[model samples]
Target: MSYPRRRIIQTGGALAGATLAGCISVSDDSSDKNTSDDGSGDGKTAAGTAQLWHGRSKGPKKNLVTNVETFGSETNHSVKLSEISELEKKLENAIPAGKGPHLFQWAHDWIGEYQPAGLLSDQKENLSVDIDSTFTKAAAEAVQFNGEVLGLPWAAETVGLVYNKELVDKPPEMVEEMQSIMDEHHDPSNGKYGLSFPIDPYFISGYAQAFGGFYYDEGNDKLGLTNEKTLKGFRFVRDELAKYIPKDHAYDPQAAVFNEGNAPFAINGPWFLGSVRDSGVDVGVAPLPKPKGGTPKPYTTVKIWYFSKKMNQGGKNATAGRKFAEWHTTNTDILSTLAEEHGFIPVHKDLAGSDELPAATKAYSKSVKMGEPIPTHKHMSSVWDPLKSAFKKVVKGDQDAKPAFKQAEKTIKSNWQ
Candidate 1:
């Protein structure tokens, strides 16, 4: 029952190199057809042919694509999977030219950019079933832009506290409780930190969520970065960064510290579970700790399959894309198999309580219960940079939380409006 240890595959540089060498090719035959038989009776001609692009660098993407190709053949559809880095550039170029793949796997936030460019379809009409009922409400919210559902969730990821069972006999229920335990047990002499987190934007996003802060206040249409509650959250993390973490470690290396057994706790995702196990660490996953008065919540990001608006308008191909996406995400057998093998949560709620999930994944599922989706606004990506920079300054002791947040609030407000 042992699985292959997952590695990061140091392909960032290689992918860039391949992109520079123009290692992308588009099939010129627009008359070929790829079909799948999912028994939904939605056999429509794939517009000439349907093309799919994915960044299957590691873990779930690699395995999921393999399963899709093997099982999806019965549904009369074909998928062309490629490395993410190369496909990113290919998608950017093809999307503008209205020649992109029928469907693409991307982060939830990308809906903002693609929706404005008219590159994504409205899921309300084309989908065979009710989109909202198929997945978690959070998953549905993440794929929407303004009021339109732009994509169907393929998989979901969220941050959670991964702790070494040997270090923490019982996981603390509150942030203060964890801090007290760390203060008493943390052994700096042995290179063991109580916690580790990167100063990167993604980590900041999760911290904000745990503190019950959101990037934008949709109700008031104002930036939430400078609110008193938000500043409190930033200060909480900064204090922990100073007291419990090593000076050399930054946010990106947070998981590495835990994997190397240099830290007992880290805020990360299921993707790191296999790596930590491979590193010989007995890791236990739990929901991110909440502040003294706040509830534990993680910023959940959904990995979704979005159809290009152009593809949807391309006639028969659009119908096929819709059918393919619906079947792929809604199929219980496919979702259960992928979740069990790939270590990701199934989007379908029915599979949430399935016995097929691993213990670690089941632990993460609790966090998913309290997860908050990334905002589906047009300016969300632009706001994170300033917020992350502000957090880093506070964490590094270069600035106080109040001032750093004020600056970030200004930046976020400007872009948000």
Candidate 2:
């Protein structure tokens, strides 16, 4: 796998909009207060209380809470966990109502929105020295808005090609090789697809990157979905969808088919590793196959904990919250334990190489080394709707790649200004 050099593209329009939104201003509320007596004299209490809201429910939540207690003595601080979907709805109302939690976990994209609303604090200046370095550069960069870090990465994942080991002992490295293998073994009657991937815009954009396509030309404030290279990427996915994947399999339903052994190869992330294992199937993971001359670049997303600037209103828990965030991310014991139980790559550089991670997780960590973090601009949220519609049209064979991309570009550009 090849690693692409980091290209920092600062387009004029986006930055100007962010500046207008007041996301570029740095606040002066950096005072730290020590409270609570967990007996460590550090203000952490064996009975300190902190509330956390996340999207994970039931089994995933229980597993995470168990790991949290194992890594840090929760006897010092108790966590109040909430479902991620519910938190999203409640956070909008809660933050303004002064009912938000001390710490919250959210997607990297939320940083841009929350930071400007005065809901989150700048994490870089507030975090401890030792914990600061534990997070990976890409993970850390995602949570940063206008160059100020806002969150500590709890876990991170990138897209990759997962295959059924029994079907293809030696998976092909190139697209052509994969096509040939599919031609030989693909049996529609057996309900097997050579490959499967999401047709939705956010997920399919990764396929475009794999073929050297980009949605935004951040350098020029222009959309590039209509560029020839990008169209070619779309055409590649469209053609593959027609030739190998089943007609009934839409992007959303593809993963279930892959899990059922209906598809020998699929494009997914580390989150599905457990499901595949539980299905009693031997799975092999590899970096996404490269286009003729282009390498596959999966869209990478990072999960981070953000402290609310508004939460500081409580005045008493602010110091302890900062300390807990620092310890949760930087402590080797904490990160490693999370990595082992959650099956996610730890943000800390030291623990990135841990052998304690499951085999699939180690493979994912290796892949993350080659992945690029998604753009963090607030306008980024606007790109998904049009992109998904365009991809679905192409895959469903309703339109040609050229016309589909042109429509996508028009939609994206309409939102840009």
Measured over all alpha carbons after superposition, the RMSD of each candidate to the real structure, in angstroms, is 6.6, 8.9
Error of 1 at 102 (Å): 2.1
Question: What TM-score quantifies how close candidate 2 is to the native fold?
Answer: 0.80
lDDT tens digits by residue: candidate 2, 210-266 = 666787655566677888888877787777544787665454457667778777787
Pairs with backbone N, CA or C atoms under 3 Å apart (clashes), candidate 2: 38-45, 38-46, 45-76, 46-75, 46-76, 54-84, 55-84, 134-348, 201-388
Q: For model 1, how does the per-residue alpha-carbon lDDT over 1-417 read when each residue is reduced to its tens digit?
A: 111111121221123333222112243425433332223455554432356666543455555556556545665544444445555556667776767677777667667666776777776765676767777776777777767877788677766778888788888778888888778657888777778655555655555655566667545656778777777767766765447876764544566677787777877776666567767898787777767776755566688888776564444445556667787888878776666654578778777667778766777777877766666555666676787678778888899978998888787667655
Error of 2 at 298 (Å): 1.8
Q: How much RMSD separates candidate 1 from the native structure?
A: 6.6
- On lDDT, the leading prediction is 1
**Clash count (model 2, backbone only):** 9
For model 1, what is the alpha-carbon lDDT of residue 280?
Answer: 88
Model 1 alpha-carbon drift over 4 Å, by segment: 1-29, 32-49, 86-90, 144-149, 180-190, 209-213, 246-252, 313-320, 341-343, 353-357
